[model samples]
Structure formats: C-alpha cells, structure tokens
Target: MAPAPRAQPSPVAVAADVSSAPVSTGCGNGGPTTHRGLAAATAASRTMYWPLLRNAECRHGLPAGLLDALVFQESRYRPLVVSRAGAGGLAQLMPRTAGDLGVINRFDAVANLDGGARYLRSMLDRYRSVPLALAAYNAGRGAVDRWGGLPLNRETPDYVRKVLTFFNEDA
Candidate 1:
C-alpha cells in the first residue's frame, strides 16, 4: 500500500519559513531576538558573515532571516564545522552537492552561502511547498519521493520544526 497524502501546512507557516517579500536583508533586522540567537556564536563569525548572508539573500531572492535561521540550524554560523556525514562550512554542504552547486571551496564562507542559497531556491522551485522543500533539504529529494512527504524518520521532521522555529523568531 502507498503512503497517505500528507496534509499541507498552512500558508502562514510556509511564509514564515521563507518569504518572497522584500524585507531587510539581514538577520532579524538586527533586533534583540537576533542577538539572542547569535549569542552562542563568536563575535567575528557574526560580523563577518552577515554581509555574505545578505548578498546571498538578494541574489537568490531569499529572505535573510530565513536563510539566517537555516545557517544557524546547519552550523550555528561556524564556517569550519564538518559534519560526520562530511557536510561542511556554514551551510554544511555535502561534497557531491557542493560540487554540483559549483562551490569549489566549501569552507569559503561566501561560496558556501551562495551555493546553499542557490540549492535552496531550486528546491523551493521544484517542490512549490516550503515544508517539502525543507524536508528535501534535510533528507534529500529521493527520500521525499519515497515517503511521499516528510519522512517518518526523526531527523527530517525535527530539522524542519527547528528551522521553522528559528525562522519564526526571525533569528
């Protein structure tokens, strides 16, 4: 038997994850909440990457706060973090994905952010659904196809919820 069709998330939930609307192209408009989220990160990391994040946002038409939320979840703004799965840099891109996205140096903050934003834009375009796109980002597109929605696995759903939480906080 096939898996049941998943219920679509509400529009507001989708928008909160990633909005196409023009907003200040930085994390949380430099609000107190944004600072609170970045409190764990070092000052240099926060200062150095905000502009790159903004640039990626403008170039990819992503909302900065959403992108910021994603980066926070992915690596906590640590440019050199390498996952056990070998995903690295601020975006935590895997090797194959980094190559496909034309990111030569995954540790290079600018390249990683740009590649991540580009890949995210493509996912959003392909799925036309924020949650599915986020699931695809976390668990890969093949899993999304196989599961017919968010996977039953714990990581993907938790990832979506956490990223959405950060995004909603405008962090």
Candidate 2:
C-alpha cells in the first residue's frame, strides 16, 4: 500500500500589514523572550517572508517547508542576526559562504534566503540524501566528505534531527 500524502500548511496572513510589522532579532535574552513571544515572532516572520521562502523553494526545487525549517533553525527568520561564527541574516550564512553564493548583502532577507537555498540545493545534489545534505548544511561539505555520510559528531546529528523534525511537522 502507498503512504498517505502529506498536507502542506497554508501560509497564515498576519493581522498587521507585513510592511509595517516589526522585525525582531529572534534571539538574545533581552526583550520579551517568553515562549509566547517567540512563537508570535516566528509566526510574524513566516507571514512576512512567506513569498521569499516560497520563491526559494520553487527556484531550487527544494521540498516545501524545508527552507522554512532551516531558516527557523538557523536564525528564526531574523534578518539582522549574526552568529558567534560571523554567520548572518535570516539564513545564518557565513561571510565567505555568502560571497561564494553571490549573496553580497547577507543582511538582506531575500538574498540570504536565495543563497542558503542555493547552497542547500548544491548539497542535496552532491549527497542525494536529505539527512546528508542537512548534515553538510549544519557542519560543512568538507565534514560530510570526511565522514562520507552523516557525521557522528554531536551537533551535526542533532541539527539534522531537529531540522528534519521541524520539516516533517510543518508538512
């Protein structure tokens, strides 16, 4: 018997006009960092960036909600986020990687999503496995090459699981 089809979640429209919605850092301990606050922020971000996310998904032939899950894991849709490793924007792209991906302004939401999606597509093409591709995205292509599969490292495996879980749940 065949498996049942997955139902994709419809994009929820924000009550406030998207153009006027405030952009939150989606991180840090400062401000209203409660669970509800974070959920609200994530929802707002989903609405605000739905168009860009969908565009990236279509352009890169990525499974629906995959980029959204990655974005949620990376920066929670914060356009101004900078990681401790110097990764920035909604996709948490490192400076070198962003430049290599032709993303001049990593802080720009659209460009960041495009670059991240492109990078993920490359990984998927190379590895031909969602878990392996996600592992490479979280760690690096070099690491995936070194391990020749999903690395046994703690963070990479955990990251892959979380992203996949989110991706499946969002479906």
Number of clashes in every candidate structure? Answer: 0, 0
For candidate 2, give the lDDT of residue 132: 72
Task: Name every residue pair that clashes in candidate 1.
Answer: none
> Could you give me the TM-score of model 1 versus the true structure?
0.80
Instruction: Write model 2 residue lDDT over 69-145, tens digit each, in one string.
Output: 78988998888989898999998999999989999999988899999999988887787667777778888988777
lDDT of 1 by residue, 1-171 (tens): 876655355442345333443444443344224445356545456566887887786688765466777888898889999998899999899999999999999999999999999888888777766677778888898888777767767688788888877777753
Q: How far out, in Å, is residue 28 in model 2? A: 32
Each candidate: RMSD: 3.7, 12.6
Give lDDT: candidate 2, residue 108.
89
